[model samples]
Target chain A: MSTNATTEIVPGWETVIGLEVHAELATATKLFSGAPNRFGGEPNTNIDPVSLGLPGSLPVLNEKAVELAIRVGLALHCRVQRSVFSRKNYFYPDMPKDFQISQYDLPINGEGWLELADGRRVGIERAHLEEDTGKSTHVGGGGRIHEADYSLVDYNRAGVPLIEIVGAPDLRSPEDARAYVSELRSILVAIGASDGKMEEGSMRVDCNVSVRALGETELGTRCEIKNINSLRSLGRAIVYEARRQVDLVTSGGRVEQQTRHWDEAEGSTHKLRSKEEAYDYRYFPEPDLVPVEPSDEWIESIRAALPMLPRERRRRLADEAKIETAAAALTVERGMDDLAVEAIGLGADPVRVLVHLENNLADGIGSLSAGPFAALIAMEVDGNLTSTQTKTVLAVLVADGGNPAEVATELGFEAMEAEELEVIVDSLIAEHPQDWLAFTSGDDKERKKKAGFFVGQIMKVTGGQADGRAVNELLARRADA
Target chain B: MTEYTARQRISRSEVAHVADLARLSLTDQELDAFTNQLAAVLDHAADLEALDLTDVEPMIHPLPVHNVLRPDVVGETSDRNEVLSCAPSIENEQFRVPPVLGESP
Candidate 1:
């Protein structure tokens, strides 16, 4: 775990990075065909002739992909415009279509900004809608494409709608790059536009890395690093690639403009292909598809459909409650912002609710909805149960759905009466005469420590259901006497 | 009938690049022949520049309808067994092809 501490690279070189993130839209059908667009289907099952690029088959645009593209645009604060589809001519078996239908000069969304958790904003150059390709499974030696004896293609993923979000070279550190992807993923998931699962290939990142001398306005030659499948690997790849570029320049070798594949096992980037004047894609308008002239009304409707985005929700939660930054980020990241807000609205303490949510979200929320969970916390707050008793009731409620009060009774946790608690505290003090003497005779510091020790001992006898505040009152009276 | 004058000759290397992009293996003679043939076709289409249509909007398709989009609805998908049957070879129900030189491992 590398802390976000600034590490000077070769003393003077600063890393400049931009990222292109390709996210598969959560649509029901392919971008241009009616074939089912889903993940993990039987190989080639989710494909049709249009997705398979068969002869004489024409493509009909899936309106859902367009709506999702606009939803992302609005969430990212981008300019949604009348966009056109063009053929990005390329050769790959993954795209059975000789040319991919992508937005070239005019994308649907343009020029947005995404703010990271630490308030660093990266500029989004464009988020263009395009079609994804089929999955290729390589067989034989090393399982790498260059060494494979044969390969398999699964068209199940083919023609899935995608939006390639291009970012400006605003990320300065490797950690910022990771934050940028994570922040973007949260926003995508928030808007319900994408699942944003990098491991599942629903969201993929291509990093463009360069290094320049400190305070230099011009950028050094950059390399595009691909195949980083996780957020940790995304950060590691940028750091390694940036260092590699710095080493190349310092050692008097010019950094070549190329595409590099990040080898996760080796932890280094190897040259995939050197660019020969930046890929002449020879883009032209797709004669099969019509222009996407979005009406203002349609764009407004899409914007209205978007939920509260991640950044706005984070800011609002931070302002409304004095939640710590990390806890607030987690609350928003896991789609718990609304729950936290609703729980707070229902008179639960904001900080405690968010803390409990952050701590207990691992094994899934189970059957504990915010209303009931808030009720459980309220019970603890009102001295009906101790914190330990509350946690027990919460666990039972989550594991087995029931009213928190009912579960508390079933767990045999009832608030101890004040008189009973005082009697129990008196008995414990008599049993531990020296400790009780220290509590009454010692200074305030020793009193606090001894009181804490007594509280632990009393909790054990009470089965962790005794209220500590009541115990404190009884002990303070004994000391006064 | 008016004849379209030839201009902007296509280079043989350009032809070869296009063929490579299309994943076609072409010989030198085939590249030369394609260069001349594609150049003539482009030159003839260049006759469209002779017309003055500055006021015209660029039409993407010949169909009368614009925004010919299907509703965002899920429809019937082909059966997996039926779709995989169309492939030349299948392993684990996926289409098997000769390993391409540059693909994700």
Candidate 2:
């Protein structure tokens, strides 16, 4: 099996992939209780009777969870419909209620489409709401769940609201699967519904991979791969699973439908269990809760509150602002897209604003507001200070939080007098007589190359405080003299 | 009055699987007895099939209410010690249970 090559290793076998993403909604309280919906607290401290499944306790649906779900649905272009809650009956120790309250037939968001960055559209089957289970820690026997002597259940995470987004089996490769997850994660974070942290298990993915003969429209038996924590692992698992299935079917063996677990340390998937005994979850409507039918006014309000999503923002930056693809992606991922847009809206140069925001500085642009940032760009553009000095001023504004001009003066970025810069440029031109002669007599190509050398000399003597454009003008005048 | 029209019998293995999922340790004799009793319950409920329920949607919950919700405000979290008092076993303030075979898929 080739790890690097997902391009037809077995010759005539195509892989079909789809993903199921489970994202925890960013709500203050638990889905059905007043327990604080938080992460990494003392075990079981963020629990209430409703979350613990105590007898005679009824669940009160969290209105904010529903609103966030609607926002996510609209972001995914899904139909926000009248949905109902169902009790998924099972006897898991992690589930204190002995059943999970989830949506069965009618999910809140239905029939949506997610367009990848490359323009491949993956249909969203449904995004349904459910309550999360408690976290279980396996104790003893190397802490592996299969061999542990005992398990401890922390109900703090129980009853956290989750929206499971199921994608249509339209993905054809491992890269496509990764792209789908990345795109979905950005949208989740953009809408402020989830933190979209795969490492923290705030967002999780279950990948279903299958392989079929080339040009075969009918699908093959798919083995679901779970326990994948990172996007890199998702790509690796899909490649490995597809090859495993293709080799099995092509070599006189049949693919068995089962669930596998991806071991990140081993870089391989192990068979968790065979899906021979089909689980009849015995799903029925939850008796303790009623249906959710959002009024048009409520739905419209949620729709109206949606911020500009990642895709639209990226498109605007690329098409209108002429920002590069990588820079636009970085700005959006860091939540600096709006700041750049605001700076540009204040008549700042789009190119300069994008460069500063995408510079990966020590302090984020969020530390300084739009007005201060625009002023810094304006100063740099007007030749009051060099680009380096402008960055220093921006840093002080971010770290110490003050007016940009005062910080610039305090940091000695107040513009050098014209004669002072002239003296520096004159000395550099005289010292580099050979390069100056070559630049004056050389063709446009050589002149353009040596122009940078003269500018470098002047900036080096002035500790990068002299503006490069001003030094260039001075050097051009000296050549004419 | 309702009359039975259709009642499908359940297999013994099916009964055992259901018991396993429910975490009930049932013996062969208990399984045999409960299989018969459960089939009787199903037969009794099959009387509904005799009436034309095709036009009527299946009632999920017998309630006229919909959209029962509460505001997203922090009320009161139960005391950890008080909540753990009801558990049969506790370790580090968490409920301890026998090691699970594995997580369900």
Candidate 3:
């Protein structure tokens, strides 16, 4: 995909998107009770009185869930505050209790920013603690909710801890929204706050998108698109919805504030309800549960115990290896940045190590120590082995533990002598004089294309034993002469 | 002045709206009675609202307590058959509810 979106998604208009990501906390018990917070069970097997919302069942806050929530807040650089739980009242059968226990006025985390791989920082409004509701399956023709004959509810997920991390309206494009969610998911997984699994409903996203004329300070009536499970769906839904709103305004209609469901199959959104028809969730503080006041000492201890987050790790590798944060981010996320750093420390070329890490080791480095890895790169760097031979030996080293030199010898792979490379390159150039003319005097694109042709012939003659870099240098030098 | 403000504070339609939110189908007579009753309740609290509370911090809890928590551990879950049978409707080891209206938040 192109790095940046096209100039005008809709001409003379821009999109403002704020995403609410709800990640279920990884805790053994429910947020407000000991109901065995397991994902899948035989329907009601995980339910207790609290989860079922039986009359007179009181809620007890889970300490581990709070700690995980605090870990999330600290990892995201939000101000962990003394937060209170409120009862968000609405008519939902999934929540056996008429109201969902959540934080409204005060959230545990506030005002954090997640930095994308491109270094654009998206503002986080707040991450408030809440309880997840039960799962409902509409059991009728087409499984559509409104038209279903009946619905079945499983209380297994009810009362499980969740943190709804709300992002500021800082995104201007669907791609930016995806980047924000991706970076946030990485951070969530790094901190062990949530598994960040969208497929299993562990992390869900709701996007509030508004479009207005460019350079207009005020925002248009935003529509909320709900439950986009995957990153692709999030991006596509935003694009479709934004364009729909643009078409509506351009065709002399006003955009309405509504909760719309993303129809993945149709590639559009369907309106669930409008603002006037929206539920008046009368929010009030829960008298059952008190404010969660984590002391400064406790919060400091949690901050101390947090692992180095993904962004910080990316920055560390980028600085140490002198690579772009974008490339460093991929290496770090793949759990290979440390190996790359160690190889760089052993005097191996940092850029080459990153390239091999990104391309060659996609499966993973697998039991290969940094010592052997560094030695392999070092051989290629010192011209003792060609790029292809180095890759073959590195594969052997990565798959089965072996010395770089022994592996190269076992495979009968060696760098062509510089004079041998010269002979091959001189022959190829003579054979393709027309192409060589283009290589020497053609435009920049043509010169690059012809250089690739000569290099391919040299590699074929040497049976992948010739260094492509050496081939290019010889071709350029011959052309100059 | 008290009667006028009390009528303004609670309208019959507002009472009916609250009843609708609670999923209660109230009669016109019931709405009228509830409106006056709610207004009287608000009238009682009106004396407190008029106080100069600028210097006072809003109390979230009557008792000065906070941070009640329990350890995360797998504990006793209610017997499935027992709870499912008690539900108004049960199907396939799950609680069967009528066609639901709102999405879970």
Candidate 4:
């Protein structure tokens, strides 16, 4: 059955999508121990007895992980109720502890909504907290383990606190699913809960995709694509998997429910396992970790502490700062929106601040290190330097941290007083008599052009110390006379 | 106290699948052993179902913490020599090890 070409239409095709995104909580220590939660350490160096699952080492809940989890739940509009930790019982060499301590039936967060860019809202089923497993590097050639060599395990990431967000089958297309995941990551970053770095395995996503007949009440058989590292890969995997399923169904064949691997290089999904071959995991309550009950006051405090989320802050920037949605999005995209606001509070013009942040700062300093750039914008807005000189001062600040004023002074940006600017303008008009005569004899447009040239010369001679606005006013008054 | 029973048990084959996804190597015997052990452990969780927990609230975290954040300051860690001394392999002020095949030089 074919429907509208612009819209998705298949006689019996409805895309069912759900996401299980695991975001590594930004904490200094592991979820159940004091082991550092840092990435890229000497293999297994970040481990402790508790993280390594040594006998007699009991897991203590990291207070920071819980706070971050609550902040995440609150940001997602999830219900932060009492939740219990259960052992997702399974034996794996990477899972130092054979059982993964996670929350099952009663998760920490339940039932939230994420508003998509298309103005569509998707339901968040549940977001629960758990610890991460160790990293395993498969050894030998051809990239196949069965062929050869022993695997080396790195426990650096093991036991890091992770919050897994599960979404309902509300995503209609791959694009919508991608947008939802992106927004979710942005929200997590904004709330200061997770780094949301997909490349570093800090944030991971698994997509559950299936296609059913249009107007069908029953859900279609779904296959899960695991560990999608990037947003681009996620959308590609969904499209490829959905089309594969549709082809299978239309050919009078059943689409097998399984976990598929997304080969980002090959741009296809390879069957990892089938449902019949899937693991039971045998989840049970972890005996070691006690159940956690957050007080109502604690939950409220976390809720109040949540910084402005990306969507809300984006809307506010658009309305209050009169910035475009895209510009507003850039400010919130990198967790620099707060710094931008702080810079504005320190006297930066909103429009110029947005422009500087989006164009110059984003390009020169990089989004992650925009702190000094924001400070430079504030300095310029405070009349410490001209806009041109602010760029120079910013470059110096990034290359070598120094006081903006000192750097500006060192670079010869000491501003000229109004009287000094008047002197420069008077000299320029006197030095260029031909331009003055042309300005007096020409039409309004020609006169304005000549006046603009004279103002530019004055600014150039003053090393941009002559305030352009004041110089322009002086030049206009002199030219009109 | 209520006695627990095992239900929805996982099989040895399922454990092996999980191990494969996790890039772990487990012998059949080890899989079988873990399956049985995990099943027994799950049996104990059945006790949670029997508890009069309807009135008892579920707890998510132990501590009542909110906004426990550090200032975004990049502080210096211990000296490089002090840190690199712990590395099994080190060269030129950096930790060096076997190169990952697909990683860039």
Candidate 5:
């Protein structure tokens, strides 16, 4: 919302933000273990020897997880290469293996670009395959969470296939970060790689935020905000954190490199740790698992099978409609772009069709075929039905497939004849000559107000079935006379 | 013994830090003994490092295989009750451990 946030917050200060998104690949089994990779189950019910980190249990890579990761790589325009898995050593209660298998130096997907909804391309550094950790529930100590006596953990999610997407620090505003995640989520879902559900923790985000004076070449030290789950939270947290950094710098304090946690309820960020105490995740390649070298033929097959991504789909729809891509974004997001495009192809007014889609049909695109949808638009376009009547007919048509005309007639939504509307408008003008004078001679704002008054009077007489556009045309003719 | 004494490859403090990361409690005597013992292992590795093999490609594993993947099918899982019975602690059919308060939430 703050396009000029730089001026608003200490004139020269500019905020820099980068995002790291972790999405769970929709696979049947764990990344390296045979345990079920599911969202929720009875605790420990989905565990295997590998998931539980039992002795003598070795991990074997899941082919489907690899394929899904590859799908993500190709969708992001990355080079899918042979990747090695490294053991990130750390001690955590939820990590039964005392280490997480992740991609360290060599990632499967490297150097890609994700285009924002506004056609701004953000550079993607890498998207590597990894395993998710188990869920932990802190028990006891009620209000004082740090004082909790113990923690309970469920291993159901352990070893679930995950693709950690690392985005370059290209985002400046918080809004762009939200757009990046939303755009990325749609791509993930459209390609059938991830469900992209942040609420369920299937998709997670961490942002690295820093601020420096505008046009300053050197980058500021960034603090990593971890586990931001929702798009709204991502924006709000960035705004708060950026201001926090700006204030700290202005107060003769240095911004230390650290990991911070966003407190949604407090609308502030709290320090989780400083760089000094950061885990030296003694990273070494996992000896148990072999390198994942995907063949070129297999990569081509995945690339061939990808459906049209959301970006190209939005671009195509916007080009066909001859409108801004942002205007067609919602229609595409709701999976109605094809329907809107097809209706447009059938000579339906693109603007009106898009407007109808934006106003109505939000719940669903309805089972009504493109032909009927086009016919309905045509009826409205020809002034045979008011947009309101068109909506009434559309509801029935969407609920039940039938002729648009028949549906209109069945609903008693017959568009008023032009002569009938003309007669009503003439009489109303004669009755209210003073208002008509204001409408004709008044300023632009006054005319719009008086026009609304006439439209209201006309709709009252016609039982809301008159075409507003037709009534306007009749009013204009009468005013000229 | 002579080979290990040829050079003190690993320091005692480094060994102590590694032991600390593993959460292993060791006395000063154990640290001194392990430092020399572990230095011998590093000495052998230093010999390999000394070899001129710049042309040889770096290999992470000796397996003649690259991709050893299994089908992503939900197969056998450990019995919850049986697994819980062997655990150090269990609460609400889940693994129970002392509350971890550190780098991550």
Candidate 6:
């Protein structure tokens, strides 16, 4: 990974990177068809005639796809202007439709910014909406395309809406590129735009990397690495490609601009094809589908419906809840930050609730919606149950869905009156006379600690019904007397 | 007749290259026919450019909608038999298809 830093090529070489990340929108149906948008389905089972690209099958826009696109646009802080789909004229066996319906000149999202962890902001050139092609699986020996006897095509993913976000050539290193992709995925998931699962083909990235002399004005020959599925692979590919380009240039060999394949095992990019010039994919407006214009009112409604993004929510959790930054980050990372806030809103002490969630409650609950557990915490905070009684109530809540107060009553956690607690404190002080004497004496701080020990024992005897704060105050008064 | 002449910007070679990248095999005659047809289409597009579209924002989709989100509930659809019935091949309750080159062994 430090190959670039360790070996300086040409005194100073700067690496420039740009990315095109395709994220399948988390919708139930295909972008331009009624076919199901599901992964790992039986081949062709999710397909409809439109997705199969049959003749006379006019594509109908999926309203859900457009909504997801707009949600992404708003999350990226892009200008979601009225956009149009154009036919990217191309023919592929995988592409059931000869042309991919994609946005070209007028993308749905334009000119956004993504801030990386290192505080560097990468500009988003455009995020266009497009339909995905079908999958082609090559059959027969060694998985080689030429050696394959035949290929099978699956239309399950066909016509699925994919938002391709193109980033500017602002990423200087592989780390920045990976961080940019990671942050983008988080934002998409936060806004309910996409699942952003790279393994399931819900999110994928293609990186364009180039290396040029530090002071040079012209960019180097850039190579585009296709379909890097994971962030770790993305970082490795960028590093390896940058190093490879630098080695070629420094060795007096010309770096060929081309599309390359990232061999995950080899940790390098092998040449796939010579770089083609900007494709005049003969992008023209789709004649069949009408262009859509979102009204001002509609756009405003979407904006209003937008949830608090991860970054904003993290800040709010840290600021309002007075939780530690790391703890707040853990909540967000686990996708439970919203649940934490909801639990707090229901009257749980934010810090205590976070601690309980992290330490005790998280294991039993498979997901973040620890509803009854949250209710138990709220009950504890309300002084209706002690912390120990709350734990038992939590156990019952996890076992069965019943009222926490009722469970607390079954376990004898009903709160005691102040007068009853006062009597207990009085008796405890009378019994522990030696400790009370030391507590009254100004010299014995250690004995005063023993006095606190006796108070705790008295409260335990009272079945934790005595409020600890009130017990302490009563103990202090009796000891001084 | 409108005196609009469509400019042919893309050559035959470029069309062939695009087709190859997309992994579709087209005959020579088909390529030539598509080139001319695409040129005519572009000419019509040029006419659209002449229209008063300065204030008319380009529309992307048909409807005005936002945040059409589904609750992240795992829906009750685990019918593997129904799904695998459509596959050309299946093994171990999974869809079996022709392997692609460059995929990991």
State which docking tier applies to candidate 5: medium
lDDT of 6 at A354: 77
lDDT of 4 by residue, B46-91 (tens): 7777888888756545555432333322223234455556658654
| Residue-level lDDT for B39 in candidate 4 | 72
Q: What tens-digit string does per-residue lDDT give for candidate 3 at A138-206? A: 888588777888899998999999999998898888888888888898989988889999999999999
TM-score-based ranking: 5, 3, 1, 2, 6, 4
**Interface RMSD in Å per candidate, to 1 decimal?**
2.5, 1.5, 1.3, 9.0, 1.6, 7.4
Best by lDDT: 5
Measured by DockQ, the strongest candidate is 3
Report the lDDT of model 4 for residue B5.
Answer: 33
- In model 6, pairs of residues that clash are A83-B59, A83-B60, A137-B98, A138-B98, A138-B99, A292-B61
Candidate 4 Cα errors over 4 Å, as ranges: A1-14, A146-148, A213-218, A321-327, A334-481, B1-105
Clashing residue pairs, backbone N/CA/C < 3 A, model 3: none
Worst 10-residue lDDT window for candidate 2 chain A reads: A1-10
For candidate 2, write residues A76-194 as lDDT tens digits: 99999999999898888889888999999999999898876644578999999999999999999997778999999999999999999999888877777887899999999988999
Off by over 4 Å in 5: A1-10, A416-481, B3-9, B37-52, B103-105
- TM-score for candidate 1, residues paired by index: 0.84
Query: Where does candidate 2 stray beyond 4 Å?
Result: A1-14, A117-120, A172-175, A213-216, A324-327, A360-363, A382-384, A401-442, A445-481, B1-62, B75-85
List residue ranges in candidate 1 displaced over 4 A: A1-12, A324-326, A423-443, A446-465, A474-481, B1-65, B73-96
Each prediction's whole-model lDDT (CA): 0.83, 0.85, 0.86, 0.74, 0.88, 0.73
Candidate 5 residue lDDT tens string, A1-481: 2233543334678888889999999998999877888887888999999998888999999999999999999999998998899999989977898999999999999999998777888989999999999988888887334778888889999899999999998888887888899999999999999999999999999999999988786889999997587999999899888899999998999899989988787888888889997888889989998888999999999999999999999999999899998888899989999998899999999998888888898988676788999999999889898877888888887887889999888888777887888888889989999999999999999999999999999989988888888888888887888
Supply candidate 1's per-residue lDDT for A248: 86
Candidate 6 chain A, poorest ten consecutive residues by summed lDDT: A1-10
| lDDT assessment of candidate 3 | 0.86
lDDT of 1: 0.83
